[model samples]
Target: DPMVMAMLVDKMQEACQHLDRLQVRISDTRSSVLVTGDLNAGKSTFVNAILNREVVPDDQQPCTALFCEVKSVDQNDGVEEVHAIRDPEAYRRDDPTTFERLSLAHLRTVVEDNEPGYEMLKIYCRDAHGKSDSLLHNGALDISLIDSPGLNIDSMKTMALFAQQEEIDVIVFVVNAENHFTLSGREFLRTAGKEKAYLFIVVNRFDQIRRKDRCKRDVLDQIRDISPRTYAEAEHLVHFVSARKTLLNGLARSPSPMARGAMLEPASEADLADFKHLERCLRQFILEKRARSKLAPAHVYLSHLLSDLRVLLAYNAQRSARALQRLDGQRSQNEARALQLAKLRETVLDRLDDTIADTAQRVADDAERHLNRFLDHLHHIPYDVTYHGMMYLWRYADDLYRAITMRMNGLAAHIQTEAIRLSSAASSVSTVVAPPSSVSSSATTLAHRDTLGAGNVPALPELLDRAALARMARGLLPGLGALAVGLVGYARSLVAPMGAGAAASHALVTAAKRPNPLARGAFGTLAFAGTLMLFYVVADFRRPLEQQLCRAVGTHLRRTGWVRRHADATGRRAARALRQGLWRFQSDFARIQAEEAVLATQWSRERDACQQRGQRITAMTTRVAEITEQLEAINLDT
Candidate 1:
């Protein structure tokens, strides 16, 4: 089953070449079988037992100090072989002076960086060194073994990495029989079981406790209470063994019979039987894992991968928003304005084109004759008519620039005047109302602006208030007033549907009883007072919306005249300066070249004399600074 899954992972890794290969390093190859536990909880020993090997290095030290991988290797002619993955130690070395290349090589290398004391698990084992030529024979099942660093204090990195790779095939948790259950151990089990891996609770060195009366059984029961998942999985499958003894027995079995006397554990028959049973159970569990792997292919994990990807997308989006917030929000407003201007230009083409054509023709006609007369006179001169022609060009350019600027300023003023006229007409029905205090400064600026003796200025008529403008708009569009009335009545009905009718009936009855024409008119207005209240409510809500519309219209008006003029002025200035400078430089070409030759000769002579000092550039700078300081002090004294 592992074979099938491994093949699938291989194909996926091949297809994802466009993405950086580093993404594949963690999840590629095969499902990692993370063998983790306490220092002497038989993690390394358990790995060796499952692989049927006596090669994993083991010691009695608190930290065993190496992360090893026993993977299938390849030989010529389709022979299957096991090879130990080797690379530089990915840990803090005894010699701490050099740390430049402390970790293992990059992800592409055989062994990845798994620095000791860091809560990461790293072991990459492949059967072959190259691509799989034959999926049947030469193809070797690849399995990553994650031997985690000690877990006295939970490392956030370790927790995150484990959470990321929650598709673990099997969790081999080794518990030492002698030690009591610890908080760290319980925490590890709780997290490990939740990952949905097949849990295996192994009691290492069970031979020491198996002989005591109910001692081994008591410890096993405690483990069951602590790890329900592990206990359930082990109901039909649990292993207890002295790994060191097993390793020695398997390796030294064919050795001289006397050499076997020094086995790591007691030489009791029961100890031998325990080790043998433990070995069989461990083998069966691995087989079960392999079977599961075959039953569910690698695509089964794609759903989890996609889920993690969505979370990552959300994280990145938030990160970008925060980054932009730090960069200054004013730029965002400028960008939005630019986009709006672009969209408006597409719809306002005919108006913009006509304006541009009119401005260009008028400006050119006004300046052309003056420029031609000057050029004609210059051509008659004998000493380089080209120079005179250039001067004529510069003057003509300046005249054109001035005419264009005037046209643009005139256009902008005309647009603003028309806008004010429309605003005036809308507000012509009632007396003027003062604008809000917040707009007082703008109002003052408008009042003080000098208007020429023309009919463009708006008269300060009585009907200049918001209410007057609304009434005028209603006269222009009948349904607009009706819509306002309906919306208000709808909202009122929601609040007091029955009481609203009673109030209306009372007002109508009072209006019907009125006799005098003026009094009847007053009563009729009073009868519709509720409707006026609703109209005011809608009017107040529409103020902000009106301001936005006015602003947008004003921006379009400003761009129509201001932007064209600005572009024209800029282009004219650049053209004029270049033409004039080119003319002047050519007219005095000989004289300027003669002067530059003299200056160059003098500069070279001084430079040669200074070069004899042979001082370093840095020293010369220091000396100059020192001299400047002394000179400053002398000036101060004087």
Candidate 2:
């Protein structure tokens, strides 16, 4: 009675879970399930059979071309809650034309009418039946039956994300009666083993085996070969059903009552009898076991949640590392650019100073001598003539000085532009690592919600929303763009002063006239001497200017209170968000762990607890197998 009670309890618990899920679906909006298998495995047909309706569009290729979910709603019911699970795309759902661009000849294709449907590879969710509205309304079960493209050649990594989130409960395995044990089916079985539950192998096409001898012998042999392995798993179960037949029965289109059982609606006594068996298995084994299993506590759930969180954190870390690497590389490149800009600034400044020095020396050496000679003849001429000679020399010197200054300023302006470009590059690199501002905001929101206990504890089916994640990324774009542009503008402003002098010099040159050859030759000699003075004075001053600029920027960054406030706010927000997420996952895991621990402790307390069904079953079976092997060995020795 104790053994029976345990089994009964397990079954009852499973039933409750299914009922709870159903209730949630009825109350919640977005819920989904993912169904995957090898080619010709009857996965799609099985889904259609379950709903007692044909909702999934069928295909004949080795793989399913698209991913689809079936949703239902109550027309009369009001809008309830919606639970949507975020997952990675099976194929390229992000791309509108992934189907047209990629050759899926090697992959699964969901073909309708022998023609390929647009490769719509989005995740599928089945809504509870009853309503027509924009959002999932009606107190209907939200069960998304995710129909994945055939898993034949696709990498398991491609499909691993779905299961990692704990989204699947029941896996209906459809095996063709004709080829019950294909190699593909074997591999599929191996993958199923990694799952938390045992698989139900549905034997399709029972009607096709018309001959009694063939049906009896062939089916039995196949079952015998696979049964031992199937039975070994604690939570696994098997079933014999035909989806094609089930569909016909549901449609009321079957030719005979015997065939009607295949669809699910039994029309005959035998068909009804089989339905009872299937229902029994579902209720006794699958549904009940799930309910009876101990609920995990926050800590246990946390461990598992942490595993996923670790994965997410790892992905983000990798992205950040790459971004930082790119930024560093860009910084290196910009350093070179900045260096080039600095050199240009120097060249322009030096050129302006050289021109001024050269012009001044020329005037001092040649113009001064000429003026002195003219002065020697000053007494011979009238006072007005002497004054005119002095005026001419002075006028020429001023004109030359202005000309040199103008040229220098123009060169300086060009250098300023380059500096702006370099500065822009630096700014872009600095802000590159910042997650979109919306990401920060969303993270903060999650934290705030945690404080309010939004996603904490045993956790709701709505753990993480993919749409929210995308929105957060979208929100951060504008700020980053502005930062990039501002850096470039700032670089140019730094060099604007140098250009000013050059422009003034050029303007003066435009106003001046020609000089005598002897005077020009003397001026050139004097100009060379003045060049040394300009470099010593103006060129040496740049180091101090650069230091002052750097200090100002650093001080401004420190003094601005807004940056600190935002950072503190964001940190508090992230801590809260992380805790909430951790709490939700751990609560479930902890509950389960606590239950398991209690069971373990109870087993220690009672000697009979060690005598579990699984152990007993395994030992008994092992002895039987060993006896058989010993018999064969004795016969061989004889």
Candidate 3:
């Protein structure tokens, strides 16, 4: 995005460099008249018509590939020659190395060859007409007629530079009378008209037009659209004449040694008169007002540059401000998200710990209290065991104890797992966020938003991988209990769409059908005790003895701290898992915040750059407007 800003603003920066150089050029003694128009528009013929000689080559083919600046021989120490400059930027009129010398006769070959090697050809020649009639013989000002290649042949930038060249005092736009204005011609006139407001428009080849009146009217209409001032001064500024005829007439009037084509059609009286009139007006505009005309290009360049500068400055300022706004909004969002994460770490994490601890403690207390009460009711408890013998009594008794313990443990663990699972489900969160566009350290800032985005999925805690404690109570529960557990798991899979508890009843009914092997083996002990009770009629000792054994076992398990240990282990696992989730959320949140910090730095640099550019733009705008006013205020003291 910064590149976008640079791409748009680089032109303005380059334009700024020209202002100082242009200011210096405004005070120069020499004046220049640029001759330009569409391809095959007879530009070279027009120049030849003005000078009344074939100083430049002209033909039906597209020639004049480069600029041919025609000036009086006085600048070349009264010598007529060609200075073919390969590089215009390094050109020095006095320095012989700057340009290659060629005979004046070689001008035609150079023009026709479409020389890509040279930037321009400087042609110095003498005027054959009397001093009074000669436009180039002015003693007060030196004017050079720079004939340029046709429009669309040169780049727009090069054309603009060519148009605003330091010494350009006036512009003469030539258009074919029969062809009228091409798109390139219209654009050239429009641009030239801005620089000097006044343009000398020569509608060439007038002798060729059949509908002379209509052609004039159409040309005026287009001129009015592009250059209102030229149209308003149509009588004085516009001319219709055949340049070839004028050239021929000049040959007839005062033939020069340089003139070629001795046999030529004489110019019509009307054509000669019109061209002479045009010559009179142009000579006056160029020489008489040379001092004032020199400032006009600067005035126009500044006027247009300032107008465009304002637009560019406003656009960059607005875009930079919007980018800053987005940065601020992004910063705020990052802060809010960070705070949310902090809450999870500080407040929510603590709440999770308390919830897990309370649930575990409650399960532990319930296990201890209810278990002791179950053991206390051992005398009243029912059993399906039939007395077989004393041999398997201990085996059956141990099984009965294990079954009760495992049942209680399974219930407690189920509650804990469900609680922790719900907690994890409740606390998880996933949110996606995009980072703001950033500015480069350089002056270029992205005028648009960035596509690189940020997102986070907070790691949710799951209960740590704790093995089932009830599964370890193997001896007490029948194989059917294991089967029941598996059945419950399978049922959960089938009825999962309904909910977790949907298939619980199916597991319980399946468990009820399977009788423990221990129950059948324990019946012998019960039968032996019953026979004693019948024979001696003493108080039955089975219930009291089992009660005594239950008390002893409960007391020993309590001493070992089995209940509290399970509860604490479960709580520790939940806490550890919850802590891990919190850490993960913090890690992700920190990364996002770090990116925001980088963007913040970029925004800082961007804002400063934009402000500086905006300030410079403002200063330049004011300065250019003032300079334009100053130039306009300058009066011709001549």
RMSD of 1: 38.5
TM-score of each: 0.34, 0.30, 0.61
Best by TM-score: 3
Candidate 3: regions farther than 4 A off:
2-6, 13-25, 36-45, 52-67, 84-91, 97-120, 128-134, 147-169, 182-198, 207-211, 225-229, 242-273, 288-297, 330-398, 402-552, 555-638
- Tens digit per residue, CA lDDT, model 2, 176-212: 6666666655655555444322455566555565563
In model 3, what is the error at residue 237, expressed in angstroms? 2.5
Residue 248 in candidate 3, Cα distance off native in Å = 4.8
Instruction: Write one digit per residue (lDDT tens) for candidate 1, span 1-638.
Output: 69976986776575455133323533454444556676567766656545434334444644433334333433222333222222234433233332222222232122223342322223223322134321112233445555543354246534643553344555566777777456677777766544333456667776667465465577567667766645665643456666656655555654633236656454466656776665455444444345433222222233233344445445544654554454335445445644544453343332433433443333333233322332233223222112123335334333333332333344434433332332233222111111211211121112212321112222223213465456535532334444555556444433422335777877655644543455434444543654565456544433322332233323433444433443343323323333333233333443444555565465455444433322333344455456545533432111
lDDT of each: 0.43, 0.42, 0.64
> What lDDT tens digits, residue by residue, belong to model 3 across residues 1-638?
89987976787676777676667767666777888877888889889888877788887777888889998898889999999998888999988899999888888888778455777899999876666667676666677888888876768534754555444677888888888888877766666666666778888889888989999889899889988877887887898888877786667645565345653556778988998889887876676665546665666677687677667667766776776677677768766866765665565445655644554454345444544555456446665444333455445445545443444444444535443553354335323332221211121111111210001111111100122122222222443344445445444433312224636656554545544445433443444444444433223323433454455445544676544554454444444544455445546656766876786687678767766766776676677678668756766435
Worst 10 residues of 3 by lDDT: 451-460
Cα lDDT of model 3 overall?
0.64
The count of residue-pair clashes in candidate 3 stands at 11
Model 1 worst lDDT window (10 residues):
430-439
